[model samples]
Target chain A: MKKLVIRSLIIVAIALTAAFLTNLLRPEPLAWIAGAPYNIFSDCPETAQHALPLKIGNVERERDFFVDARKAAQFEAGRIPGAFSLPYDSLFPADAAKVDEIREAAGGWRIVVYGDMPGAKLLADDLFSQKAGNVYYLEGGLDAWLAAGYEVEK
Target chain B: MTPKKEKLKTILAAVGVPLRVYIGAVFIAASLFKIYEPYQFALSVATYQMAPLPLINIFALALPWVELVCGVLLIAGFWTRANALLISAMMLMFICVLSVALARGLQMSCGCFASQDAADEIGVHTLLRDFAWLAVSLYVLLFDDGRFGADGLLEKWRKSHA
Candidate 1:
């Protein structure tokens, strides 16, 4: 029993060492602590690009990086699968912090924002201005996504 | 030992080796791609909305290596029971995560192998697959006894020396 425990520990140590060493040599090593969440979201909508639900669905079929700009309550009710929630009336600290986390983690991915109102447009422009590349808004928001027969995560 | 008990041991000893190799190879295949792209794996983990953001990167970084080491050890049949237990635990964790993701209607890939954006999305089939692996791991954990492996050879050598 003692030998088994020791062997398991050794394996874990070796694995950790290999992982860290290989990661360190990468040209763009990932942050040890991702999204050090300590920023506020306050960007305004400017030049927000728009896309139809079908187009966005087709483009991001595999890795759909959607950002839901609906209210927290609405988001809780239902949302596009894998979509990140960043309700525009995000006066709460949690929502604001989420914006910060998304800004950091979304990285170079094609981020598509959607909502029933202009919140999606505003959030997309905000993210784009914040250097979030390839940011766009959904033409008809969740309704469009549903209309296109995509499942929602509730 | 009783005949029935001895017969059971013989059966387990016979089957354990192949099961270990199969599970080990699957694990090694699963880990390689994850190790190659920790960042994308992190994104996939985040998509689950399970782990906190701060922990996602580290989980992505360490998990693949854990899988790799356990896999290699299982294939080598060194500490076979321990490696099988580890694999079983990982499979259980995966099964639970997949269950929640599917229940919540998540549409992300399983991220078990290949890229995070692989066509194999999380679904009932993925859950069933993990459950199958978990069953194999449990069988190995219960019946493996240094047979057809380094452990078996070491035991033989020890008995001969004694």
Candidate 2:
């Protein structure tokens, strides 16, 4: 029995050593553990670093058109100077040509997108995938702009 | 020791060699891949969701080295019984972890073998595969097959003494 216990202990020790060493050799355990299946692990886009944050001081000149992808009432009350209204739900208007219209209006200039909630980033990624050129986010959206010394019309 | 007892020990030692060699070869292969692509292997380990966030990096660094050492000892035929038993224990632990993860309904990768090749989501299927390896190791304890090993020398000496 004593011998058996000794042997078992030794085995346990070696196994543990192997396990620890294997983990030591492995690099980024958190990412592996997170278990997100969809996001193909890819290098962060180089352009992401260069993309500027949108704000009122430069919202008009910097962006081709500021899209108030928020509720209609919110848009009517106040938005970036010279900004056009396009609520989130109404983006895919039945007309179908609205995509073209938005595209043409946003031609040759960056489109700054803002929304009322968190889905804004996903929408931005999708819009960028759909060939929206030089897209930027307002960092904190209109809320942040409002907090940072900018006035809303309403 | 009694003749029967001596004989049993000889048989146990004799059975251990080839088992160790085969297991060693596998460990070496596993170690090589992990050492070659440490970061990728770490990511796979993390995907398993077993270790805590802070310690994942440390485990990633240590596991490959352990495999290499254990592999080399098995291949060299040094410490045959001890290494065989060690490898067996490791396989048993793997089986347990795989089983628990499967039962929990967590979709993850096994990260047991050389690569997460497809990032093949580990499930009940992976648990069975690891159990198979554990069974092989347990079998080695009974029939070690240590023909070309240091343990074989001990077996020969015991035979002459009897």
Candidate 3:
């Protein structure tokens, strides 16, 4: 039993050594955990800025183009008037043609994305990364929008 | 030997090697992806929403190494019973997590042998598959005779030396 414990410890040590070596040698170091790239929400003026928070009043006053970045079912259930649906879950790095389409349609007008907080932030970051100008996100999503007495379009 | 006892021994002997190899190979293969892309594995672990946020990264970093060590030990037949117990314990944890996620209607990847995005979605099939692996681990714990392994050879060498 003592021998078995020692052998197991030796094997575990070898495994840990192998993992440490491989991670050290890899070209692109992985983040210790998964998260958005730190620079995605840059405060620097040279690069794109962090997503601006767009309130319901500003959305109504400006009549800016809105992009709903929720799931399809959520978008179908209710949304802001004249809002274009762009389900965030389906958008991948490789296939972002829909984003391009929305950019083209907006014609450089301010775009406001709203949905679940993380999804909204992700989509807003993606748009900013793609050089979309004047991108913003609705603070607190549809629930907040409704609470602020904004009308929903079915 | 009695006929029944002989038949039972024959069955165990015939099945033992394949079962150990299957469990070992599966664990090794599964550990490779988790070890290589630990950040992705962390994301998959987070999808379960069970672990506290601070520990997710720790769990992701350590779990794959444990799997790899146990897998190598199982294949070498060194400390076979202990390794089998570890593997069985992991499978039981997996079964519990999967059950909870399914009951809660959380649609996320199984994170079994792949990164979160690339892995198959968690469902009843995943639960069933884990249960099957758990059974295999238990069988290995009970009937492995240490044949065709370094453990048997080590014992022989020690006895001769003594």
Per model, state how many residue pairs clash.
0, 33, 0
DockQ versus reference, model 2: 0.07
Q: What value of lDDT does candidate 2 attain over all alpha carbons?
A: 0.60
> In lDDT terms, how accurate is model 1?
0.74
| Regions of candidate 1 where Cα sits further than 4 Å from its true position | A1-3, A36-49, A52-154, B2-4, B109-119
Candidate 1 residue pairs in clash (backbone atoms < 3 Å): none
Q: On residues B1-162, what C-alpha lDDT tens digit does candidate 3 reach at each position?
A: 999996787578548778988999999999988988877777678656787766776677777988988888888887777787778888999899889888998643211222324234667888999999999999987777565576667888999999
**C-alpha positional error of residue B63 in candidate 3 after TM-score superposition, expressed in Å:** 1.1
Q: What is the per-candidate TM-score for chain B?
A: 0.89, 0.72, 0.86
Q: Which stretches of candidate 2 lie over 4 Å from their true place?
A: A1-154, B1-16, B108-118, B142-148, B154-162
Tell me the DockQ of each model, to 2 decimals: 0.21, 0.07, 0.11
Chain A TM-score for each of the predictions: 0.56, 0.52, 0.62
Query: What would the per-residue lDDT of candidate 2 be over residues A45-123, giving only the tens digit for each residue?
Result: 1245333445544454443466677778888878876676666663453123544565678764566777765445444
Better of 1 and 3 by lDDT: 1
Q: Per the 3 Å backbone cut-off, how many clashing residue pairs does candidate 3 have?
A: 0
Report the C-alpha displacement of residue A14, candidate 3, in angstroms: 4.8
Best by lDDT: 1
